[model samples]
Target: MTEVFENSASFASDLDSKDELQSFRREFSIPQKNGKSVLYFTGNSLGLQPVRARKLVEEELAKWAQYGVDGHFEGGRPWFTYHEHAKKGLSVLVGARESEVVAMNNLTSNLHLMMVSFFRPTKSRFKIIMEAGAFPSDQYAVESQLKFHGLDPEQALIEISPREGEFTLRNKDILQVIEEHGNETALVLMSGIQYYTGQKFNIKAITEMAHQKGAVAGFDLAHAIGNIKMNLHDDQVDFAVWCSYKYLNSGPGGVSGVFVHERHGDNPGLPRFAGWWGHDQDSRFLMQKGFKPMPGADGWQLSNVNILGTAAHLAALNIVLDAGWQKLLDKSRNLTAYLQYLLADLGKTFNDFKVITPEKPDERGCQLSLFFYRNGREVFDFLTENGVVADWREHPLNETSERAGVIRIAPVPLYNTYQDVFQFSRLLKLALEKEHERITE
Candidate 1:
């Protein structure tokens, strides 16, 4: 039988002592509050910065100062191939071959590029399927794609929502909808993990279903790439796009990544918006008349790599690679499970607070979304004032009958420790108590 966890400071300290990755906490510069490290639980929004990021970026700056234009080729780590240094590490993180992955443009930009090539809707199959309430960027991208193709979004876009009274969608229902609309649907685009609920979708199963239905499978993995283990190649996911600023710990507005399956990546006949950087390497500087795309995902590039951003990414990826994927995942699972246990324990004292995130381990990632019966915003404000850094999502009152909000807490394994989880639980309990006293008085 497994040992039961105790809700005590000593227990948290013991767990920290036994943690294999405990030393990694020192590698990141944690934000301070009242002369102490703030309890940060918002890696899903923006990850903490790695200490080595400054050194890596400065090296490129020095090269730029000394070599100027020659920095493209003369530097030790030439800007010409700067992105390549990070590709191997990123591919390992997303479970793709190096050639299939490229560190490039922002998330939405890559999504647009992928849709241009994959969302080729004919008159017969003009519909696009996606989750209801997907991240707004995806909604806009799909709507614009339909408009760009001279189709009406109201007629061509299909959104699959949860059953009445349910907070999350079921896999069976999603597959059924795909099967029913297979003939008319041209694309199936969804998030690997829903941002609001922190619910992890079955990517492999969904991809297989889309392929069987003759539609292309693509994912916006902004919340999934570093948070969960994915097998995009084996899952046969046609393409994927993710931003690096979240769980990957790159700086804010960092470069993003894209994955195009080998089948489509190597095909020179595939249509894409082209530029000089994407041309054949040998003839790249030949001032060539014809646009010849390089093989694999690199062929989709429009401009040269952002050297400074790539340096930050390389620094962060090195930490992830050195720690190993499996070890990080194991820690993530345990930390989340511990957080869930604490929340459930706290629920006994506060009947008004409920956890909406899925209870099953495989169904969710590290984030736990909490729904309060009343004064959700007040509680959020209380926590924020008390130095708990978390995210809050409020539903528009006009769109729904009742005003609702969810507090999202993500305890990342790379820098977040057992003590952080314990501190959050303690602070949350105090905040709820204070709020309850205010309401009753």
Candidate 2:
């Protein structure tokens, strides 16, 4: 069936007609190029700002200016427990109890902190499981953690790879790997959504399998947190960490959140890198001599909260909570499906394009990774020239080959419209066609 989209104008009108979250587009300050808003398809890289983020930040700045040291005690709103304000909202997004969630540090930093307590590798069982093509930061953090434990990464890290000629891993293959080496694996740490291929892993199934094999289960939820519903507690994941910058709409390098299972709440014997912020608030001001930790994830915080950052996160989380993630997710699934439909049609009309993201909707998130068979770099440059914002991932297959990368177009539901996806599809087709003409000439 024909897509029925006649022109960009028709698509725009259709977008105007059906956008349930239309008001949210005004809630962000979108980047513009050449006097027009760029067709942004890179929310998976960094989400658009919430209109109220500045105001929230300003509020913290005002408090700091008015009361420097006093801000921690008696400033208006009191910065002492400011992190608690973001707790309820962050918890909701990750599907954990409020006590099980806390916001602090950046993504990789939090990953390291979580590892300090959870990554206990013994002589007999001292291996970690993860994807071979994980984000560079994650890979580096894991490698460094292994080294810190005095274990060689080559010996302690079990990196899973897809079979030849495939972009995504099969769930069965992953399970088999876990079963084969489960007894020797100390921890199973993997991304809830694989960054390069836009593949959403089966967190629940994997966690269950890892636990059955006596391995602790955890996740790097950087790409999964806001893009998908992760019931961290119910999934029985030992622990998980995620950043707020991407789908969470918390701006660049936003504070990260972590989840610790309720089972660990009363386990005071668990080792953690703690600080005054993690101490009991009732006695924290008492300046006690001994270390006394709070219960659950909050006890893991190493220092005072970043008020401005947490405020920005709260500003965005408020919108998420109010919008109802279920509705947003429903829209997200359909919007991505629509984008895929448009891309598939483009494949029939153009010979240069193919989608590398998983074909099953349940197997991926809102982003679709598209590979251009020829002139991929030229096509990317052309897309940028035409005012469309997308991201290209570094290819692990050929670290030196820049042309072998894929363009990632993430159609975020909070701010992106169907028209934006339509425009991206059109622009990509035109760019690929132009590249083909230039190459043939």
Score each candidate by Cα lDDT. 0.90, 0.86
- For 1-441, candidate 2 gives per-residue lDDT tens digits of 123444454865575567677777788889999999998888898999899999988988988898888888775568888888887787888888999999998888889988888889999889999988999999999999999999999988998999997888999999999999999999999999998889999999999999999999999999998998788889898899989999999989899988899898557778888788888878987887877789888888889978888888989998988888888887788778878988887888787657888988789999899876555878899999999898766566766554677889899988888788888888888987887789789
Runs in model 1 deviating more than 4 A are: 1-3, 396-403
Q: In terms of lDDT, which candidate is strongest?
A: 1
TM-score of 2: 0.96
Superposed by TM-score, candidate 2 places the C-alpha of residue 350 at a distance from the truth, in angstroms, of 2.4
**Mind giving the per-residue lDDT tens digits that candidate 1 earns over 313-392?**
99999999888888889899988888888999999889867887899889988889997656788888988988999988
Cα misplacement distance, residue 279 of candidate 1 (Å): 1.2
Candidate 1 yields a Cα-based lDDT of 0.90
